[model samples]
Target: MTLRDEITNCRICAERFAATKTRHQPRPVPWFTPTARVLIAGQAPGLRVHRSGKPFTDASGDRLRDWLGMPPEVFYDLSRVAIVPMAFCFPGYNAQGYDLPPPKVCGQTWHDRVMAELPQVRLRVLVGGAAHRYHLGTKAGVTETVQNWRAYAPDTFVLPHPSWRNTGWLTKNPWFGEEVLPALKARVKEVLND
Candidate 1:
């Protein structure tokens, strides 16, 4: 099946949304190109992205650009990067924090197919715990930490969420700036350069 078809038919996150206090309608269009070299696997959108319908189109986008040292022009280019967030829609939040989980339906319904379409994804950025947990499975844990990132290097990389809440996290994990930042840039440059 085509990427768009698989995404449109996703029932994973949608089911969870139905049970939430706030809900979001899903839009699985804008299937990205296979040439996309960077795959940003993030948590579902927030209230803002739900309204805008563009992935990482909020403050988080700004932080992500800062980390990547990329101008908005290059960062927003779908041809260069594919943004397949864990949950395609903004899966409303809870009082505790974000919420319980990103529907099993998303991975079960569409994730594999979408990844298949984007063969050029060289680096998959696992943003936030849910994205990391789902993508990395039991291999990732809260105690596992972003500090000892080498434990999960190369093909997969863990990142603090780009949300404002992570500014302190960015500060605490200075190595993310000193070490991971350089490597991430080099990787992006290599792909963008090519």
Candidate 2:
């Protein structure tokens, strides 16, 4: 069976998820194809995404798409864009109702394999601290990592999470919008249109 199918049928986190406040089942949302040119490596799915079974189906997605200057048609096109999160399943909420970090086993089991399948990817967009940490192997906090976006630019763009929870962060770091995003949007357009 294909890797996608394997991931779709995965139950590796069933018992672990069954113990969360949500007590939800593992619903892996694997969205990618070999021909994809852009890769969006994000944190785990939010509850809305868990329910939709589609990556970035919430307000965060809307913000991310705007950041990329991409319309939904292009952003959702399997042939051009791949949305792969650190964990395919929602890890469920904590007692405070915040999303738990994605289970590491999911990445440990499938990340390399998924990347191997996408040999054509030319642009990678790392969203949030989890993706930044895993993909860049950086110990810096999200703000610093994103501030140094130039080090990985033209091919990769490290970004803060687009969740509304970070609105204050965005206000504090206006340069991210004025500097990083314009360049990122241009690069995204160039890469996807190439």
The TM-scores, one per candidate, come to 0.84, 0.99
Give the C-alpha miss distance for residue 73 in model 2, angstroms.
0.9
Q: lDDT values of the candidates? A: 0.72, 0.95
Q: Candidate 1 — which residues are off by over 4 angstroms?
A: 9-18, 29-31, 95-100, 142-145, 151-154
Query: How much is 163 displaced in model 1, in angstroms?
Result: 1.0
Question: What tens-digit string does per-residue lDDT give for candidate 1 at 52-91?
Answer: 7677788998988877778888877888877877767666
Flag clash pairs in model 1.
12-105, 12-106
Task: List ranges where model 2 is wrong by over 4 Å.
Answer: none
Q: What is the C-alpha RMSD of each candidate to the true structure, in Å?
A: 2.6, 0.6
lDDT for model 2 comes to 0.95
